[model samples]
Each structure stands twice: as structure tokens, then as C-alpha cells.
Target: MISHFVNRKRELERLEREWKNVPSFVVVYGRRRIGKTRLLVEFSKNKNTFFHTFFEGTKESHIKALRKELAEFFSDEIFLSLNDYYTIFRYLADKIDAKTLIVLDEFTYALKGDKELASKLQRAWDHHLSKKPVMLVVSGSLIGMMRDEVLSYSSPLYGRRTAGFMLRPLGLFDSLELFENFEYGIRTYMLLGGIPSYLIVASKYRSIKELLKWEFLTPEGFFYDEPYILLSQELRELKLYFSILSAIAVGKTRISEIGNHIGVEARKLYPYLENLIRLGFVKREVPVIGKKNKGVYKLNDPMLLTWFSMIYPHKTEIETGVIDIENLRDELKKVMALRFEEVAKEFLVEINKRERLPFKFERIGRWWRKGEEIDLIALNEKERKALFVEVKWKDLNEREAKRILRDLELKAELVGLNGWEKFYGLVAKKVDDKKELSEEGFSVWDLADFKRFISLRGEV
Candidate 1:
């Protein structure tokens, strides 16, 4: 809708290249309304393709609709209508006699409605469509269904895809371009992440307070029912998960404390916490370099975090006016700024990927153990070496950087001999103009470094 501008250029290019290759099946996924459909369409505009959408309807009705759409692409094939769902595969085999692009959008819907869809697809593809000479794309919105129904190792269509794209929200740097100024841009982004719909509603040059009054605090607003809608789609036991999220957003992260605060036993909350982490809305952290089981969780989505931390709890305020709305709003903003440190670490993680440290890292998480903690930890498990990092949101004066360096030196010494080979990096959002960073003992990074990482072709 917005001219499909900026970011994901590499992904588009790769997709285009694959479309021209010998038979390739691609699975494209992301949260709903995230421009996944727009991207697929834009990339396939001039290509010979069959695109179809599945919606909430009976299986026979969907098959009839799909056959009708497929018939649009085939001029000579005597395909009046398609039945016996398996015949759709036969139809494809007949139609793609030459090279073609075939798109199945909202595939999760089909799989949801017809439990045998993946097996049906597998049969059709293997028996009739595999060598038909075409590029195939299966895209969906319901993340859990897409993974378990079609992509899991045990699924019928598993391993059929030549490549897959797990499309993520837009980057903050490119995302900020929608707003007029840095302040509104940041606040808007802080709340909305990079989801296209949420960003479309963000006001330019408005104070955070004005934005809430004008855009958010309303019945018809974009985010008014967002958390509920998102949660309802993704979670089954929604209330407990939401309660835990609200507790963390309100600053109760310790296992015992969050459990006590939310009236959930610590053990019962683990599944919800794990799910939140997998969804990228919440983070679990341990005290520096701790194991997976030994960490605390923090609210990772600032907007939703702020929403639950402030807005949700104040639902009655709209009717009763029992709370000081302005004070609550101000406190929410203050706490969010404090939480921006975690956001900064996420930015640094992206930079490390671009640098391509000597090791190939499958996962990069932060670490903390006892009195020692690194703001970011990039572990190249293949090489068994880790990059411990310090991230500062403030600009580092010469004195400040020196002090950080000294403290790092002490920590490194305490970490012992093997820690020398463990790379140490320092990152800041802003730093005084002093010198080029690589000259220093530690690898230094800032916003420029971050922008450079995403700029790399095929990097994201």
C-alpha cells in the first residue's frame, strides 16, 4: 500500500532468483497484516503465476474457488472446475507444462480446514506436479499451524521446500522513515515495532501523549484491540499468558516474584514464558552466560509491554475516571525508556551477524552469571567461542569509555585465561567523536554499524 518501499531488497532479489530456478517450493511466513501478501504479489507481478487465497469457508467451496482461480491462468486446458482436492495437483501438472510460478497464499487456512491438505499436496506434487517445471510458494499467517501442519520434520510436505523465508517485521531504521521526526518516530516505533498496520497509524511530530489521545485511546483505533486479537490467535490458554506478560511488563521478572504476583505457580508459568520467548514478544535472561533453564524473562515488545503495564490495567479509567491518566501515561513512558536497553541489545545482535565473527553462530543471546554480566553474548557454538559485549545507550565521553574499558579489563581478568580468545565488543547508541573503533582493545559498534549490517546484500 505504501509503494512497498525500502528494506528486504535482498529477500526479494533472492526470491526472484529462486522463481527462475528449477522447481523450488518456498514457504513464506510472518505475523498477519505484515505485508507478506503485498510482498509476494509485488515480486510476482510480471511472472507467469497462479495465485489463490483461502478464507473461512467449507472445503468444497474453497476447492471450487481455487479451481476457478487456476482456470484463469490456463487458457487452453479444458478445466471447467476442480474437484476431489487431489485433482488440483493434477490440474497444476497439466497447466505448468512450461515453467510457471504457483502461489498458495493463506495456506494455513486450507490446512486448518482440511486436515489432510499437506498429505494431499504431497501426493499431488510427487505424482503429478514435481517435475512440471515451476516455482512454488506456500505462504501463511497462523504461525503455529504453518510450522506444525506443513513445515515440521514429520509433516507430509516437510523437506519439499528448496528454501523458506520466515519474514520478520521491518527494521527500526527503515521503519522510522514513516514518521516526520526522530522523537515521534522513536515513540511510534517503540510501541509498534515495525508491523505495517501499526506503523500506518503512527502520528508524525506528535507528543506521545497526543498520539495516545488521537490514535490509540479510541474504539476505532488500530491498537485498541490489538493485544487481545493477537493473543487470541496465537495462544490457547490466553489469560495466564497475558497475566504473566503483564507482570513482567510491570517489572516482576524474578520467577518467584512473577509467580506470586500473577497467582501462578512458577512451574505452571514456564510454558507460557517459553511460548512468549518463541514469539519474540518476551525475553528470558540469566544472570552472564547462564543456561537456558536459569534465566528471567523481560517484556520484549515495548508497545504491548506498555499496553499491559499501563493501558490494560486502566480499562475502567475510561468509564470510571478513577485514575490519573496523565500520571500513569508519564510513568509508562519513563519505564519504557528504561527498558530501551534490551532493545539496544537486539540491535547489536544484528550487527554481530554482519561482522560474521570467525564462528558461524546459530544463536546469539545475552549472558550473566553472579556479579558478572555481558549486555550481549554472541556464541559461535560451532567454534565454541563467544563474543561478550557491553552496550551503552548514552554517548560515551573519553572518560566514560576509559572507565568502561577498565571495568571490562577487570572482568576479563576475573573471567580467566580462556576468556581472552572470547571476543569483547562495546556498543553505544551515541559516542563522542574520538577515534575509529577497531583501534581500541574491544570491538566498538554504534548506530552506523547497525545500519551497515542491514545494508549488506543477503544479510537480513
Candidate 2:
């Protein structure tokens, strides 16, 4: 089991600083299982805090639940008579004479039954909460809904927030802490992404193969039905969203391609695509130096991409126990191979931040031209310098690495960085003669190098 929290030092520091200024209204939100609740709990450890988790139910039921929690906390039956969110919040503001922390977790669920609660909250904060020495934190999982209903310009609570944070998944180095080895950690990351809840669960398994078997192949596993659960919470057009995601998963990136696969017109798919983009599941990508209208849509969540690509289509066979690890072996490799490109991009960004690259690149992303693509590209336009890279998940020997580098040089010319001093790099699962290649003026890296980089940073 993992023994400690990974890298949330920056977030913790910000929370502490915010809490020092009493009457602080903080809004915290992110995707599900991203550790927002855990962060708040950790931040509240030494403070007089009242934490309430909102449930999905009617207003009366939620009010009843809140009343019970308040009665127990203050040891007063008077709270039992308090009805509605406005009264309870007013009571909280009035009763907290000293500095105190109040957390309303899953604020989306709380507002589900009472749409007017936000406006009520606005009035409460204006009349009482703003005057009290209380640090109030509200967190939610439905990012789209939270932004629209609470953080938007027309939102009642828009101007009331003193500070807010849209939490993101942990980075690669922090995610590596959940596994016994870097190889397994990287594989698990490709499948589950950097969501801490999934990482912690995967950490218990002896190997990534076992984790995939139990969590993905089994119908009752936590991740088996997670996409459906998460998507249905924020989206109403489930069938269309699934179709679009499945199309993108299977290599249909362009709007025309996806629309054709889904049997829909491209124009008609705009709303659905926009919603997916807004929800952070699908991203539209254009070549770093290409026309915006000629972009493509791709899955942004590795976990969701894996599910729709592999498990969703074969759910029946998996659920009936007809499909086993052997059946999934090749498909797993394919998924990992695609995901490794993204991992390689991340690696480039990290090394760039550390100034480990030959040049400090101002921009980096995948670059492509008609019928040609570069796996990774880092460019410093003002300096007229560029780095073209090819990422491979297979083991490569000296000759094979050299061949890839030669091909990468050919691709680099098509990247439209004419007159720029160009460089070539290669990343693979394992390289036979990395030192020899580096001596030859190519930036060659392997899995072992990544592990060394991550490990050294962990120590420091």
C-alpha cells in the first residue's frame, strides 16, 4: 500500500495561505476520484472544521441529513428545527465566533434538488458569511456543471469566491510512487492515467497484468462501469457521446472521419463535440503550426480511452468469462503503444523544464503535414531551433535506432520549420547502444533513463 500522499505540496501551501485570511470563500473542483476531498480533509486536520458531504436526493432529505450532522456537531437539538440551506448556512456563520473551517463537499449534488440554493448561498454570503471569521470551502466533481452554475459570470456565487482551484491529475513522477517498479507504474499510468484513487488501487497488485485482469476484465470492478457513470452525470446524450468517443478511440480523429463513422453529419455533431470538449474528455487538436479549422478530436482521458477502445466493445465476452488475459495480450500492447506517444510528450516537457534538452523550447506538441506526422516536436521559433522526435514502445538496437533517426530527419523537413537549425531524437522501451547514439549527436532515451530521472527527482 502507498504510505504517503504524493506531490500536492503546492496545493497544500495555497490552502494554508487562504485559510489564514478568515472569511475566505474557496471553490475546489475537478474530475471524479482526483483527491479533492482528501486534500480538504488533510487541510482541515488541525482546524475546527465541519465537513458535510452532499448526497443526490431531494431537498427535504438533504436538509434532514444536514440537520442531523449539525445537531451532532454542536450538541444542540436546535439545529433539528433548521430547514433549508440558507438557514443552516446562516446558523453556521452566526455560531462560529472563532476561526473555523466549513467544507461542503459535492456541492453539485447538494444543488441538484434545490436549484435556487446557489442564489440563496449568494444572499447568505452577502448577509452573514462574508462578515464571519469562517473559512468556507465548497468542492464538486461535475466540472462542467460547477463552472456553469457556480463560477460563470451570471452565477450568483461568482463574485463571492475569494479563491478557487480546478485540480488536475498528478504528474508522472508523483504517479510513479504508487507502484513497486517504474515499468509497472508506466503501464498502469497508460491505463488509469494519474487519478490517485485508481493509482492507489492499482498499487496493491503485484503486477500490472493482475491489476488489468481484476479491474478491467471483471464486470464488478470499480473501473468497469466508471465511464458510463461519469459521463451520464454530466451529459444527457449518452449514445452520441459514446459513438464519438469510440470513433476517436479507434483512430478516427478528424471531424469528417468521426462523423462518417458515427453515421452523423459533421455540422450536427458540433454541439456534442463542444460538450465533450467542455467536459474535458475530448480535446480538439491542430498541428502546432497548422490551420485551426483543420484540427482533429482526440480522447484526453487515458482511462476512458482505454475503456472505450478495448473493454467497451468486448464487454459481453469479458463479462461471460469467455475472454481472458491471453485474448487481451495483443490489444493491451497496442493500447500501450499509442499511449506511450503521449507519455513521451510529457517526458519531453519535464526534461525541457529541467533544461536537459539541447535548447529551451518555447512550444512543443505533435506536428504533422499532409499524409505525414511527427511523433513529438519541440520548437524555439525565435532562436530558429527545432527538435523532431520519434517515440517507440519496442526495444531497439543501434542500427534500428539509427534508421528511425534517419526517418525522423526526413519528417523534420516537412514540419515547415525552414531555415531553422534542426535536431533529431529517439525514445524507445529499451535501447541497445544509447551512449553510442548520444555520442553521434542524437538525443536517445529508454525506459531506464526515465526511471533514473524520476528516481533522482524523487530523492531531491
Candidate 3:
């Protein structure tokens, strides 16, 4: 499938500004397949660049390869005999006279091969490279290793970096370019997510079912072992992490429920849960109404959530060739509904960015009280203004929409905003006579309205 670079305006702008500053050291990191390498390559364009991608190998082998690259770049066989990275770094620092960009992509692999590489690089920076006009860019996929080795307070390179950017998956609006419909885009955002590699593979497929068949359902599919690989890269105890993630994926949101599922106590799971949260795989959230005690945990990565919820649980069935894609398709509708709520929240944020909401809200999130839940609430506590919203993923007729709005008003009262100036909104797949509802003094939106608003703002 044809793929095009969508947008990284903020990152690109930051890198451009760094390029103007001499003797800059920048650290760029993110999870694997999140486009860290692509971003570095994009930033290195039209500049004097020395780009080296460290792969799985021994330190001697990688150093030899790096020596060859340097020898070729400088047209000198002198670099051929260089033994270590320190000497190589000194050579580079001494040779380069002009502004240059040096990108060490996947630098974690080199660190894995040799633990001393970070200190060596730190020495090189202090004694040689820092005196030059070189802009050093180090990028890594292993978040934990990169943080400990390059960014932690105790590391040799600590306090030396001029800037650091942690790249995240693209947002819903940026990901819409991969799909033809708002519905499809929302579904994709909830499933494969906004990771560019996943989106590129998705753009080749016609639908989520097809994408799953090609990349997940089959034993030899690209994503069949993705969770295993991802877990192995950053984690030590694979089985424990897998169990925790599986429990979280299968409707076990509370800490107690997850602990029960994994046969562990709630307090004992904090380390694993905290690590997962740090890795961006799981998220911990508290209710908006009562933030004192009640909280829940959920899988943050859509791809991982889908794998644990579907493919991982049924791995034996899939491997034995008895898996039914149609059955999975039937279940996907329910899964898509939960994801639609997330997309609806993102949609509101996008419109909020355009100042299209009733009043600008500083916070938008799901609020819950006992058994009562509001899908989306945008509020500005300082101004005492709140927008209460209900997100429905199904088509809603005018009567059904009005009933939901009425229920929302009651729910808003339960939110305990006595003096707040409140507004009501309903987001649905299809809201019959949404304009009429909007004219009736409530802010109402449907998929078509959301699509049109996004298109008008040049976001799609």
C-alpha cells in the first residue's frame, strides 16, 4: 500500500530549532513501531548527516560496521583499524569541522552489547564532541533501557541533553488519513491504533476484519507474535506481564479483579502495574466525581488489548486451524462500541481545539459515581462551566436522542455542580435531526457532523 507522511509539525519544528543551535544533544525515544526512526530520518533530510542504525549483534561486530561506515564517509581507511567507540567518537569529533547531524538509531542495542557504551559516549561528548558544532541525535525503541542508560539521573549522559522528545502514537485526527469513513477511522483508532506501521499495514486492507485475518488470525501473520516480541524487549518476566495484561484486557478493570484473575494480592501487583503504566501498556484512572479512592486500570495500547482479548486467549484454537473469523467479527461489534467512546472523546477534543464547543473546556474525561456513568464531560472548573455529554455508538432516532439528553441533565445534577453553568451534548453514530436538537438549545453531534467539522477544519 502507498504510504505518506502525515504530520509531525511540533516535533519537526523542535528539531529545526535544535539544528540552529550548535553543540546540541537530543534524545528521542518511544515504543517500537512508533516511527522514532522515521522521524529521525525526516529530520535529517537536507543536512550533513551521519546516520547509523544499531541492530542485534555483538559490540565488536557493530563497532566494525560503524568503522566501515565512517571509513567510507571520510574516504579514509584509517578508521578501519579503530578498535572501540571511544576512539571512533574522538576521530569523528576531531574530523568534523562543519555542522552535522549524527543519528544513532536504536542505540539501545549497542548498550545491550556493551554496558560501557553510554559512559564512553559521555566521555566523547565531554572531551571532544561537545566542543564541535555537531547535533547529536540518539533514538531508541526500548523505553526502559533508554531511560536508565541515557536519561536517568545517575547515567553518564544525564543532564547533558539539550532536549528530549518522547514520541507517542498519532492522535485520532492524524490517523484518519488511513481510512475512508469516520466510522472506519474510529474503529481503526480503537483497534490497530495510530501507530504508523500499523496504519500503513491497515491502509493496505479494506476493513478491520481483513486486516485482522492477514495480520493477526493466522499463525504466521505479521502480528501473530507481536505481543510476545513487545513483551520480551522491555520486560523480564514474560508470563507475569502476559497474565496481568490478559486479565486487564478481559473486563478486569479493578485492581482486586485483576489480582483475583492472576491469583495475586492487590498490593503485590503494584510493581507490575506501575511498570506497565510506565511502559504505556496500561493506564490507571480515577473517577472524576470521587477521586479519593476508587480507580481502575485498563490496557492503553489498542493493538495489545485486541491481541490479549482475542488472539492470545484463543491461540491454541487459531494454531489448530479451527478459529472462525466470522465469530470474531460478531464479537468485534461490542468491542468497537467501547472504542467508539474513546474516539468520541477524542473528537470532542479536536473540536475543542478549534474552539467549536459551547465554552472552552480545560478538561474532558469520563465521570462515574457508584453505578452512574457519563461517557464524556468537558469542564472548566475555574469558569464553573461544564458540558455534559453522552456518547452512543449506534444510530439514534430523535425520540431516543431526547431521552438520552434528559437522562444526561439528571446525571449532571448528580455530578454535584450546583453553581456550574452546564450545557448538554449527545454524540451518536447517527442522530436524527441533530440540527433541530442543536437549535433546541442543546449541543448535539453525530458522526456526519463530526466528519464534516473535521473536514472543514482540514484535519481529515
Model 2, span 4-59: residue lDDT tens: 67778888888898898888899999998899988898889989999999978999
Lowest summed lDDT across 10 adjacent residues in model 2 is found at 451-460
Quantify all predictions' global Cα lDDT against the true fold.
0.71, 0.88, 0.88
Candidate 3: tens digits of C-alpha lDDT, residues 1-460: 6467778889999998999997999999999999988888888899999999999999999999999999998898999999999999999999899899999999999999999999999999999999999999999999999999999999999998999989999988788876666666667778878899988877777777787888899988888999999889999989989999999888899989999999989899899999999999999877655674788898889888888878888899899988867858645766677777887888888788788988999988888977999988888989999999998878999999999999999988998989999999998889898788888889888778767876677654
User: What TM-score goes with each of the models?
Assistant: 0.79, 0.97, 0.97
Candidate 1 Cα misplacement greater than 4 A, ranges? 1-3, 75-80, 203-205, 287-293, 319-325, 346-460
Q: How good is model 2 by TM-score?
A: 0.97
How many residue pairs clash per model?
7, 0, 0
| Cα lDDT of model 1 by residue, 1-460, tens digit | 1334557787898898787686888899877777788788888888877888898787877887887777767763455555767877777787676778888998887877799989999888777777778788899988888888878998999989888878888777677666656656655676667776677666442677766755556555566678888778778888788788878877787878899998878888777788877777788666444455676778766668767876787777743545544757565655555455565666655554566554545566555666576566666555667666676756787667767766775675554336335666677766654364456656666665654554563543
**TM-score, cand. 3:** 0.97
lDDT of 3: 0.88
Where model 3 places Cα greater than 4 Å from the true spot, the runs are: 180-183
